[model samples]
Target chain A: MRDIYAPRIHGIDTSEIRKVFDLAAKIQNPLNLSIGQPDFPVPAAVKEAMIQALTDNKTGYTPTAGLVQLREAISTYLKPKIGFETEPDNVIVSTGVASILFLLFQTLVAKDDAVLLLDPYFLIYPALVKYHEAQQYTIPESFDEADVNSLNDRLKKDGKKLKLIIFASPSNPTGKILSETQLRLLSNLADEHDAVIASDEIYEAFDYEKRHVSMAKLSPHRTLTLNGFSKSHAMTGLRVGYLAAPPAYAGIVQKMVTLQQYTMVCSPHAMQWGAITALKTGIDAELSVMRKRRDLVYGILSKVTKLPYPDGAFYVYPDVPIDSADFVTRAIERRLLLVPGYIFSANRNSIRISYATREDILEEGAGIFCDMVRELG
Target chain B: MRDIYAPRIHGIDTSEIRKVFDLAAKIQNPLNLSIGQPDFPVPAAVKEAMIQALTDNKTGYTPTAGLVQLREAISTYLKPKIGFETEPDNVIVSTGVASILFLLFQTLVAKDDAVLLLDPYFLIYPALVKYHEAQQYTIPESFDEADVNSLNDRLKKDGKKLKLIIFASPSNPTGKILSETQLRLLSNLADEHDAVIASDEIYEAFDYEKRHVSMAKLSPHRTLTLNGFSKSHAMTGLRVGYLAAPPAYAGIVQKMVTLQQYTMVCSPHAMQWGAITALKTGIDAELSVMRKRRDLVYGILSKVTKLPYPDGAFYVYPDVPIDSADFVTRAIERRLLLVPGYIFSANRNSIRISYATREDILEEGAGIFCDMVRELG
Candidate 1:
C-alpha cells in the first residue's frame, strides 16, 4: 500500500512519557512517579456540579467557544490571579491546555518560524514545533539572566528571528518557576524579537516557595496564558482548559476559536459547568500536601544526585551520574517508572521524577531512584 | 503589532452555521431548525454511567487512545454492523468525530494533495482541506451513479490524483443515505484512485428506510469509519467519539493516536466510561421519533420547493425560489432559524431545515418556510 501519511506525521513520534506509561501498565503496583497529572481525586463539589449539569440536560453542544458562564467564571478567576482585568471575550475554553496549545500553534506558527524554547521544557513543545516544520532554538545552558543574554547573542549570530517562545513554569519535568526578573528579561526579549510568548501556567497553583506569577502579568500585550483545572482540581479526565489572550491579540484569539470550531467543536459541555464550580473552590489544603511531598522527594533524591531545588509544580529533575536512559531502564527493572531527561531536553544526564503520586509511593520511588544512582554511579 | 499568525489561519473561516447560531441566540423562542445535534437528552443509563464514573473518581486521564474497555466495546459494537471482525487495537477513542477527523487529516493530508468531497457535504470538509493547503475537488452535480462516474472523469481530465474521499452517510443537510450499490461503486472508485475512504457514519442510527451501509463494509482495506454516540445516545456535550481503522491502516492509526496524544490527550475520561454503557444501550425509540419528524418536515416543505426525499438524519435541504441567504434572513425576522444551502454547497438556491427540534416546532417551522417560499416565489 502507498504511504498514506504526511511527512509531518513522522516528526510527532510518541513521547517517552507514553513509553513509561506503557511499561508501567505491565508492572503490578509499580512505584510510579512518571505521571504528570495530579493523583488527587476531583473535589466533591465540582463533581456534583457536573452531575447537576448532566441531569439538567446540558448534554448537547455548547457554543463552540464554550459555555458563557464558564468563560465568565474563568475571566473572573484570572482577573485577581493573573494581575489583569480580563473579560469573557479574552477566553477560549478548550479540551485541555494541551488542546489549546495545539490550536495556538496551528493558528500562529508556520514553516521556518523560529520557536524559542527553554531547556528541559514540556515534552510537547519541541514536537509541536517540529510538527509545524518550525525552526526550533533552545537555550540549553540554564535559566538565568546570563542565559537570556546568551540566547539573544546566539539568535543574532545565527541570524534567526524568534517567532514564538514557549515555556511551562513551574515547568513539567524541572518544576523550576522562573523569577519575576527572569520573566521581565524574557518579556523584553520577546519584544525585541517581535515574538509571541506562550506561558504554560498549568502548574500555576503548585508554586511552593513564593506566589505564582504569570507571563500574562509580565507581558500581557504579547503573552498567551495557558492554564487548566486538570492539575489544580484533579480533573484531568474531564479535559477542560482555556487560553487567555490579551486585548492586543483578540483577533488572533478569534482565529483560534474558529479553528477550534472546526476541530474540537467545543470542550465537553457538562464539564465546563463543573469548571465553573472549580473556579470558586480552593486547593490550599491539597497544595500543602504536595508541598510536603516535593520537600520529601527532593530531600531524598538530592542525597545521591545534583539537581535544582524545585520550587513549583510536582516534579524534580535530578542530574544522574549514569546515562539517564540506562538509569530509567534500571529503575523500571526495580519496579519504578521514571522518565529520562532526554524527553524534555537534548541532554541525557538527568531523569524527571514526578512527586504527584501519594507520599508513600513518592518516598519509596525516590529511595529506589537514589539506590539505582548509587549502584550505577 | 506584527501579524502574529501563519497564512494557514486565514483559510479556516468561520462557517455559516456559526453565524446562524449567533443570530438564533438573539431571537426569543425561535422555531429552531438549524441545529445539527439531536434534541433528545442523553439516555438515562448513559448519564448514570458517567455519574457513576465521576463518583468512582475516574477523573484522571485515560490512555491517549482512550479507555481499553471503551475501545473494546466500540470494536464489538462495530463488528456485526460493519460486517467485519474488529479488535480493540483498530479503535482509537477521541474527543469527538470532528476531532478524530482533524487528527486524521493532519496525519494524512498534506499541501497539494487532492481531496474528493461530495457536494452539499458537512461544512468542515472544505475548511479542513483548505487549512491543510490541500487541493480539493468536489462533485457538485448529484449523488448517483452518474455523479461518481463524472467525478472520476473530472479528476482524470484535471490530472488530479485523489488522496482522500470524505462523505457522511445519512448526511447532515440532505439526509440522503447512500445505497449499498452506491457504496460498492464509490469503493471501486477509491480502489481505482488509490485513495482512502473516510466514511462519516455519525448518523448511522438515524436511518429509517433501509439498513445503513458503511463504506467500511465494502472497502475495509482502505476505509476509516468515523462514528460516535453524540447523535445516537444524545451525548453531544460529552464529546466522545471513535475511529475504526482497517488492518491495512494500523500504522496510520498509530500515527493519528500519537497526534491525538499531543493534541486532545484523551477524550474526557469519565465520558468514555459512559460511552461503554452507551454501546450496550439502544436508541431505537428516540430514532423513531426523529423518523416521524423527518416525514413531517419533508411533507410540508415539498409542497413549495424541489428537494430530494430525505430518508435518514434529521434534516431536509430544499431548493428555495429566493436567494437562500435572503431567505434565511427573512426567516430570522420571523423568529425561525434556518441555514442557507450555500453553507453546505456551492449552489445557493436551497436551504437546510433541521427537524431535530420538537415536532410542534418542526411543524410550525415547516409551515413558516412554505409561507415564505410562496410569498417570495
Candidate 2:
C-alpha cells in the first residue's frame, strides 16, 4: 500500500536533543545534560495534591476549557505577575502549552498563510506551522535586541497574508528577551497588520535580567500568552499548560479546545489539581536553584575563548569555532552532548547547551566542551 | 472591539438533559445515573504501580508513541484477545481512546470527505468528524441486527468518497455486538471501498453473552482497533488508551501524533506504568463485576412498561413511555438521572441508562425508573 503518512508530518523529525538523550540512556550515563527537563523533583505539595485528587476520584473528564477553578487561578496569577488582566473565560487549560500552540495554529492559520518566526526558535514551532499547510517566514534575531523596525518592515511586506508571529522570550537556544519597547513596537505593528501574536512564555520564570513582560499585557487585543507548569515547577511529565487570550479571540481558541476535548479530554484531572497547587504556591525556591545553575554554567561558558555569555532558560548558545554539527559530533565523542544550533534554524557555527543539570555535571560537561574547543583551536 | 472569536466555535446551548443533571446536582441525588464513568476504584495493582512510579520519580515524558513497555504489553494482550498478531510497532498509547479517535480523524479525513458513523453513536464522534471539516454519514442502527448488505450497498454507492467507517462493538447506547459474519461482511465492504474501519472496543471487557471479536482481526489490512483501561479497569481518570493498526497506517497515525505532541507528550508517564500493570495482571474480576451489573440492570430495565433491551457497554437503552426528554426530566424530579437518547442521536423516545453504579444504587435507580415508566404509561 502507498505510504499513509501525511506529507506535512514527514517534515518533523524527532528532536536532536532526544536522540542524544537516547544515546545517553543506552550508555547508562549518570548526570547527563542532554534533555531540557529540570532536575528537581516535582514539589511535595504538588505531588500531594495529585495523590489527593486521585483518592478523591477526580478522574472523570473536566470541561474542555478545563476546571473553572484552575482557569480562575491562572487568570489571577497572570494579572498580578504578568500585568495581564485575564478573566477565567479567557483562559483554557490545555494538555500542555504545546497543545495550546497547536490549537492556535489550527484555528488561526489556513493553508498558504505565513507565520513569521523569530529564527533560532523552538524546534517544534516550525514543524507545527508546517503541519497546518502554512508557510514559515523566519526573521533572524538581532543579537543586541529584537529589532522592531525590521519586523515591521517584514510585516508590511507580507501584506495581509501573515496570520501569526510566534516568539519565545527568554527564548530557547538563544535565551533572548524582547525589551518592553521592542514588544510595544512589535505589538503595534501586529495590530496595524491585523495579525495575531502567539507569545510563548513557557520560560518566563527563568529569566535573569529583568522581570518577564508578557506580550498580552502590552497588547491584550491581539496576543495569546502561552504558559505552563512543565518548565517552572519541574512538572514536564505532568503535561499541564494553558492559553490566556483576550475575550475577542477566546471563542476561537475555545472552539479549538472543544475539538481537543475529544482527543485528550481535559489534562489528566490529577495533573490539573497538581498544576493548581504549583500556580497558587509560587516557584521561588525552584527558580532560585535554576538561577544558581544558570549562573554557574554562564560563568564557565563565558570564560571560553569565543563563546557569548548566556542570557536565560537552561541553555547557552555558544559560537563554535567549527561547524556546529561537527562541533557537536566531536564533543559527543569526548562524552559531552550539546544540541547543534543549526537544528533550530540555519546557523552552522553555534551550539545550544542546556544547563538543566546538576552543578557537577554542568562543570564536567563544560570542561569537556572547553577541552574540545581548545583541541580544535 | 470586533468579536475576535474564531468563526468555527458554536457555543453549546444548555440541553434539556444538562438542565436535569444541574437540578439533580443541586438536590444532591443519591441514585444518580447521569454520566458514563464506572463507580470503581482503579485496581489496586494499577494504583500501586502509579505510586511506585511516582516514588521512583519516573515522571519524565515518555516516548511520543508512549512507553515502549506499555505498547509491548498492549501488543501482547491484544494478540490473543483480539486474534491479531500485533507487534509493539503496531500500537501507540494515547491520552485516551478519545485522543486516538481524534488523531485518526485529523490524519485520514480531509475537508468534505465522508466518514460513516453508526447512530445512535457516541456523541463525540460526529463533533470530532465535524472538527476535521469532514462530513458525517451516520447510518442509523436497525435495533435488530445490522444488515450488512444494506451497509455494503451504501458504501458501494458512495465508494471512493467514503474515507472512513467507525463502529463500537458491543456498541455504545445500543450495546449490540456484531456477529462474526456481520463483521466479515463489513470488513469486505471496507476493503472494497478502500475505507478505513476504526473499531472502538473500549468496552470489550463488558461483553457478557459471548467473546468480543475485533474487526481488525477480520480485516487487518483496513482496520484500526482502539481499546483502553478506562471502562475495563475503572481508570477513567488515568486517561490512557491506545490504537493498534497495520504498520502502514500506524505510521501515519504516529506522525499525526507527533504534530500534537505539544498537547500531550505521552500518556502520563506514571499512568502508562499503571496501565502496564492493569494489562499484565488482567481485569477478569472487574469484568465479572461489570457483567453482573449489566445482568441486573438488563433484567430490571426489561421489566419497564415500554423499554427495549439493548446489548453492550454499561448502558441499557430503553424507550421512555413519555417524550424521552420529559421522561428524563420527570426522573430527575424524583432524584434519578439518565442520559436522554437525543444526545447520542435523534432517538427521541429512548434514554441511555448506565449500569456502572453500585448494586444498591442500581437497584434503587432501576426501581424508580420502572415506577416512572409505569406511572407515565
| B1-377 per-residue lDDT for model 2 (tens digits) | 43333344442223344455557777664578776777777877877787778767777778888888988888888887667667777787887888777777667767667787878888777776776667677666652235555665665686634678898887777777777877877677677667788899988877777657888778887888899988877777677999888765766666655654645677888778989998976667766787888888888878764443445678888888777878887787787888888877766888888877788998999999988888877
Give per-residue CA lDDT, model 1, range B1-377, as digits (tens).
Answer: 77778988988888888888888899998998888888888889999999999999999989888898998888888888778867677789998998999999988998889998888889889889998899988875256778887877988888887999999988887988877887887788899989999999999888898668878888989899999989989888789999998888888789988998889999999899999999999888898888888888887888888997787888899998878899999999999999999878888888998888898988898898899889888
**10 residues in a row with least lDDT, candidate 2 chain A:** A2-11
The C-alpha lDDT values of all candidates are 0.87, 0.75
**Candidate 2 segments whose C-alpha is farther than 4 A from its true place:** A2-13, A19-31, A143-146, A280-286, A305-309, A374-377, B1-31, B140-146, B159-162, B248-250, B281-289, B304-309, B321-335, B359-377
DockQ of 1: 0.85
Query: What ranges in model 1 sit over 4 Å off?
Result: A140-142, B140-142
What DockQ, between 0 and 1, does each candidate earn?
A: 0.85, 0.44
* Best-fitting candidate, scored by lDDT: 1
Fnat per model, in the order given?
0.86, 0.44
For residue A12, give model 2's deviation from the true position in Å. Answer: 4.4
TM, every model = 0.98, 0.90
